[model samples]
Target: MLVRPSLTPQGAALALAQWWELAGLEIPDLSKVRGGNPETGLTASTIVQSQEPNLTPARLVQGSHHPQVALVQAHRLAAACTSMDALYKALDAFEGCRLKANARTTVFADGRQGASIMVIGDVPGREDDEAGKPFLGPAGGLLDKMLGSIGLYRATNCYMTNLVPWRPPGDRSPTAEEIALCRPFVVRHIELAAPKAILMVGGLTGQTLLNSTDGIMKLRSQTLDYRLGLDAQGASTYAQCVFAPTYLLNRPIEKAAAWQDLKRFAQKISAMGIAI
Candidate 1:
């Protein structure tokens, strides 16, 4: 067995020289550590070395550095956005979020932007990806009926979007890193839309935006206060988190229970004087 030693620069040089000698090739000068200059044969150590350090190795290996710049750039872009139009435009221009690179187009939002009820889903699905809209898949079909049961519809009564604007590769649940990267855009969406009530769809969307670890079962069928806006802007606004349609779909037997919850939600909105 060829035992290896802990190699320092000097030891590495020695190893190289020994290997070259064994190979019967002219041993290169180790004093000049750098390779020959591009213009001249005279060699010297290089000032610039390797490529930039990959903070995210998975993204780097995938041949994209988009996700790396997402968090900071998203925050800056969202902060500069004062309206939904501006926010959408900024999101379109954002090259970060690896999902965006793989996705066919930007699935920003769908339905009525000014609607009092805002529905937020986990992320875009395959159908949504094809249409460049959030929801509209099998889950979306169920969502439409769910809303219709309470006399709400996307075309006229409600607005819809996702926790993420881009669909995850292979429709997988988004990673913590991916969610963190897209958070700023979600926050901005809420601020600009200013919906009277927010319906967070599924476990991931509910947990991430609400900053809770509680499962959907524990969190569902109850009204929870969600704080919006930054501390710098006087104070944060409050909204409600409702059960997602996906949860209802998973537990088909619980549709009746969801209906009851929806009724209560509708009543609350009615009390606020917003027509369903």
Candidate 2:
């Protein structure tokens, strides 16, 4: 049997510092990053998000590094898109995200554009990347059924897309920098679609959208405001988190809880007088 060695604390810290430098981020105070408790065992990659004003990834994409500069370009392009088609074109043309190079294709939103509800998923999975669409394979089938339960069919009343359009290599979670670069496009998508409600699937989706460190268990089944900007208008939408279909597949026992969340989601939509 091949035995793997674990990284020593010093090695781990060095690696994390290097990553921060490469990403054009300053290494935050390690003690504070660990919440002043080394036993907390939080790696830089796994740090809980803070409630800082700059928590929004879209807000971080400018004048920092090459990646951030690309993010600025993304914002300029995204702001120019007045329609979904234009946004799609922009995504296809954009080359800021490194994931784009290795991905089979750029996965875009699926379903009707003007749908009253939009479902935002985490990064695309392996199957989705191959198909160049969000929510493909078993997970997608499960999502379709889940949506159908609430009379929100993608074919008719719901629009669906992933937060990051391109799939990461090995279907790994997207890095913060990658998400930051892609966020401008996502913001424009939400604006143009103008969904009354947004169903955020997966922990990463909820965390990124709400700018909270809370996990799915804490964030689910509640109607929270997903603010678009901090300006005078304070444009926002009713958003809720639910278990990803992929998660449910791995933990079927949690289906009961997922169902309850779905029911609450449906109730919230109805209370808001959304026909779907």
Candidate 3:
């Protein structure tokens, strides 16, 4: 058998250097990102989120109520859309939310349409943005495992999306104002999908959807109703908040509580007569 030739040491080194250059792979740009330490080896090193204030290209028109006005417009835009694809286009066309300007791409839903459960998370991370799908990378892997523990998979019973369809600069938690600005699209998404259940993956999801400023612990293990209209008799959806998978990755001990929450969530699905 003929042996495959490999590059020489010098040749390999030069090739790798050229490859990196072509890929533009360099130390993360600190100016447009925040909150990670490169010295610690990337865990320590996360790709700089693209929306860091005053770092990335300028976005966000600064006015006290301009954001609110923009959100109202977003709601109008969302309301006008009659389908998921339409809504996505509307969101893509939306110019108000500052996060959209710097984010790599819109990280939208991935999974079955009209699935029994819709899982919502905070903003997309670097991986999710790159893939243009929500729930990817380490946090996504953990989410897949957690869902499996309860006999669920995104491709099967669950649908995934984010509170903010874009990533915040520097992998930082999204500001409250940003969540509010992006809220309407998700509201429209839930309305169109009309899933029987929802899982809010972090405190941001909990706080924004529940309209409470409390932390996740204060909201965890609780089942709440999502208001679909002004009247109490209007269409509603059931939702629960759990510890975020990303957070759980950092603190593995939290897995037990998250597991308990999922089991209970499964029970709710069963109670609703939907087979898991």
Every model's Cα RMSD, please?
14.7, 11.6, 18.4
Residue range with the least summed lDDT across 10 consecutive positions in model 2: 1-10
Flag clash pairs in model 1: none
| Candidate achieving the largest TM-score | 2
Candidate numbers, best TM-score first, in rank order: 2, 3, 1
Q: What is candidate 2's CA lDDT for residue 129?
A: 88
lDDT of 2 by residue, 50-94 (tens): 221352334333232344235445666677787888788878877
TM-score of each: 0.71, 0.76, 0.75
**lDDT values of the candidates?**
0.66, 0.74, 0.70
Candidate 1, poorest ten consecutive residues by summed lDDT: 1-10
Off by over 4 Å in 1: 1-69, 232-243
Best candidate according to lDDT: 2
Query: Could you give the candidate ranking by lDDT, starting with the highest?
Result: 2, 3, 1
TM-score of 1: 0.71
Tens digits of per-residue lDDT for model 1, 125-185: 8899999898787788988887888888899978988888888889888876577667778
How far does residue 43 in candidate 2 sit from its true spot (Å)? Answer: 32
Instruction: State how far residue 169 of model 1 sits from its true place (Å).
Output: 1.4
Model 3 gets an lDDT of 0.70
